[model samples]
Target chain A: MHSIDFIVLFGTLLAIALYGTWKTRKSHDLKGYLLGDNSMKWGTIGLSVMATQASAITFLSTPGQAYQDGMGFVQFYFGMPIAMIILSAVVVPLYFKLKVYTAYEFLEQRFDLKSRALAAFLFLVSRGLAAGITIYAPAIILTAILNWDINITILIIGVLVIIYTVSGGTKAVAETQKQQMVVIMAGMFVAFVVLLVKLPDHIGFKESLVVAGKMGKMNVIDWKFDPTNRYNIWSGLTAALFLFLAYFGTDQSQVQRYLSGKSIKEIRLGLLFNGVFKIPMQFSILLIGVLVFIFYQFTMPPIFFNKTETDKLATSKYEQQYNELSKQHQQVFDQKRVLLGELVAADKAGDEESTTQLTERVNKLQEQQESIKAEAVGLMQDINPDLDSKDSDYVFITFVMKYLPHGIIGLLMAVIFSAAMSSTSSELNALGSTTVIDFYKRMVNDSATDAHYLFMSRLFTVFWGILALLFAVFATQLDNLIQAVNILGSVFYGPILGIFIVAFGVKYVKANAVFVATVISEGIIVWLYFLSRAGKLGITYLWFNPIGALLVVAIAVVLQAVWPKKTT
Target chain B: MLKNDSFMDFLKTPEYTEAPVLGNWKAFYLTSIIFFVVELLLFSYLTIAY
Candidate 1:
């Protein structure tokens, strides 16, 4: 990386963090600290909500996911628009009516203390761990790509987020996110434009799509109803609906974003903005991946995306084996390149028979190429079993580093760092608010002065930030920890959503029955997760949301029916 | 501020009846849904045609 790149990167990140801290330094009250004094407009809330969800890993892994699997992943977000509508029409108004600081506070009002505590505790466990991952996921990828020290990268992201978030609280998080979102979106747009410009002169936008489509990378919507399929029309529409409901409706991280809105209208409008734009944003990212795949078709891509692991393979005992595989991979690439030229020609000339024949040859070579790449990954795994063999996360950064110009590299890096901070700040801010509002204030001391609560909130924000940083540093040595954290989130999200569904929809089911049913449902969900892991169940992880959610409602309703009502 | 209404009553409130800026909540929601449907159609066409 150039010195100019380093300057641009640090300059952009520091300016946003310092600006956020300076802007909201005077927000001293609990409401101001936790809810931004209800001063945020719809635009800020909307961007903040998007920023909170779009972690660094989303930018890194998504395009890579598209490159490998195609655009079918876009279907995963099909439920978001309807989910937003539901939140705006129903959930937002209820939140406004209650005037609650945290979503869990509503549980206390609707059910009982135990129910609120249970929900709040689940959120703390899941989000607390996730806060670390938001920092660690990007830091690992950035360090790998840039050859920077992992510990330093983790500290820079974690401490930078902590500095502003601890200084100015929720308002700071919202304000900084506005700048971060600009960086992220602008960086991605620039990257996409550059990709288009760099493509072979013969391949215009339409031609590029044709090339991608012929390779089956343009497959966007899968109509099949396979229960085990992770992303399809059915899973996206149904399972993802429950997940979004739980995430946007019940999760404190997202709730805290819109809860900071100036008015109920702003909150509604803010959520609606996400609904309208999220799919397009995701599609654009995936398209960048497809474009990268096309670029690699003309120019030979590395046998594996992670150069660090592959670089080490040369010195290891498998040196001869790795070299042979590399030779095989290059031969496949050469043959595929010739076939692709013909395929493009056939496509241009409308030669149906030749197009079909050329496409088959190209695809066969592509399969052979992938098989060699898989062997390379297995060899890496054999060298060091602890290393994660999946290098999709490395794909985008590798492209940026190799292809993009110096200053643009820094800006893209800033885009990623900004994403890491944007998400971690919100997580820390939400964690602090939930700790104070849901647990500390309600359970420990409700009579504290506003200033005392504000002080404690800042203290808790610093506490969680440090804890997340600690987790991020420690997370480096663990294999497959990010996926484990994601699974942990899924396991808890359904049960949490289930509790909320019963609280909102099943009014006949009171507190005691719902609490017991939640415990039982949680146990059942955990068992199901293990069963699926053991290959005893054929369901995808997304299905866990609906199953767990319905289980809670079903169990609670049954329990409520048999149990006698209190004569209050 | 903390009114404990049934789920149906909550849905019946003015907050759900009309969007403050858009005037009608149902219309606003329909617009969002319609936008999403159009996006799906466009993507579907791309998939089949490409």
Candidate 2:
């Protein structure tokens, strides 16, 4: 980050944020603060909804994922469009007719207050912890690449979010998201163009893709049936379905996005818009990662992308041992590069057998690289027990710092900040709304005046913001922020989605069935997840969503029929 | 697609609308079938393709 670009980047971000605060300054009442007085149209609501879900993790780890894995991860979102359609058809109209401020509000009317509080508490606990991971995701990288102090970056991001949110409330969050989404999209386009220009001049896009294809990075459509395989077509469609259904239907952060819409129709349109574009947008980001993989083919990439580990290796007593691994890694890299060149030539010259041999050699080189990285990590662990060794999260940022020009570097930095703020602000905004409307006002004092609720909303916003910042400070144990949230959501979302699906779809089953079924489903899901992690079960995290939801629906129906209870 | 008026008949008929009595048996059955088919097809594709 040089002076000029840093100035432009900071100036632009601060201006947009300040402008949002100013624009929403007149939001004096509780409805104004929480729901923007229902003045926003579907377009703004749609963008805000997308921005909230497409957090800093979406920008950071996703591309890094694409760079390492290719566009196949996009398949995981294949179920999203269908889920969105279902939400629009069912959940939207239910909430609109009920005129509920929070999704949990309906649980009280439909079931009881205890059930409502249970759902709300679960949301607060999960969203609260997840917020920190989202904030820390981009901050860790910026700290590493620029050698900027991580704590300072974390504080700056936290304080900026707190300031604008404290001033303008949800109105500012929505307004700023509209602008942040634009900037994020534009900055990514710039990143993609810059990478294309950096590729070999004569190869063109097709050969670059062919290069990516020759590598295993082009595996887009894996129709694998293995439950443990996270990104195959099955896990993606099923697990992603549950995840999306729970997220858009039950989770307050997303529920509140549609809640702010003027009518059910507007809400439906907003959600439909997100559903249509979500998959394509993810595909594009993953494609950028695949391109980065191709970009490194012609360039020298570090033996390990995470500098924290390699730095430990440098100072270790086994520096000699580390040096040997480095040599082997470099030798393999060169060997692979030569073979890749030969593979491309052979492909062009129509030599099938030579192509086969070259493919084997390239795989051998990548395997050697992995072994070298693992050995180096082991040495670093021996040298200093406290050293961080994860490299998957650091790959894309390492590429950006080593290759991209200075001006665009600052823009990409802003993109990270934008993603963090957009997502965090949404979380804080939704948390405050749920607290005031669902808990404090509804359960504690349902007759509280609009002004009091509004004041409490701002109060909770500041409270949760501080809580998220505190969580971000201690979230160092998470290897990748993106994966951590999904893990949390997979456990919680399945049962939550099941509760809603049963509420709408299962007419005979009352809330006891769902409540009991949810408890059972959640227990089983957690047990299964732990078992899978321990290598006993083969279930993937994605499948947790559908499995838990279905389990609740199935169990709840049977339980209710066997042990009948009066309807609410 | 089910016609709006025809679909509306199941849920919004005057008798059911005036007094809540769970009148959408056909809609319930149809929706159940649809979800079953979708989930089954998705799983079947995975099993066969894998």
Best by lDDT: 1
Question: Residue by residue across A27-77, what tens digits does model 1's lDDT show?
Answer: 979899998999999999989999999999899999999889899999999
Looking only at chain A, give the TM-score of model 2 against the true structure.
Answer: 0.95
DockQ of 1: 0.45
| TM-scores, chain B, all models | 0.55, 0.49
Candidate 2 residue runs with Cα over 4 Å from true position? A386-389, A477-487, A565-568, B1-50
lDDT of 2 by residue, A315-417 (tens): 7788889888888888888888777777878877889898778887888788788888888888877876866676666777787667878878777777778
Residue pairs in collision within model 2: A67-A289
TM-score of each: 0.96, 0.89
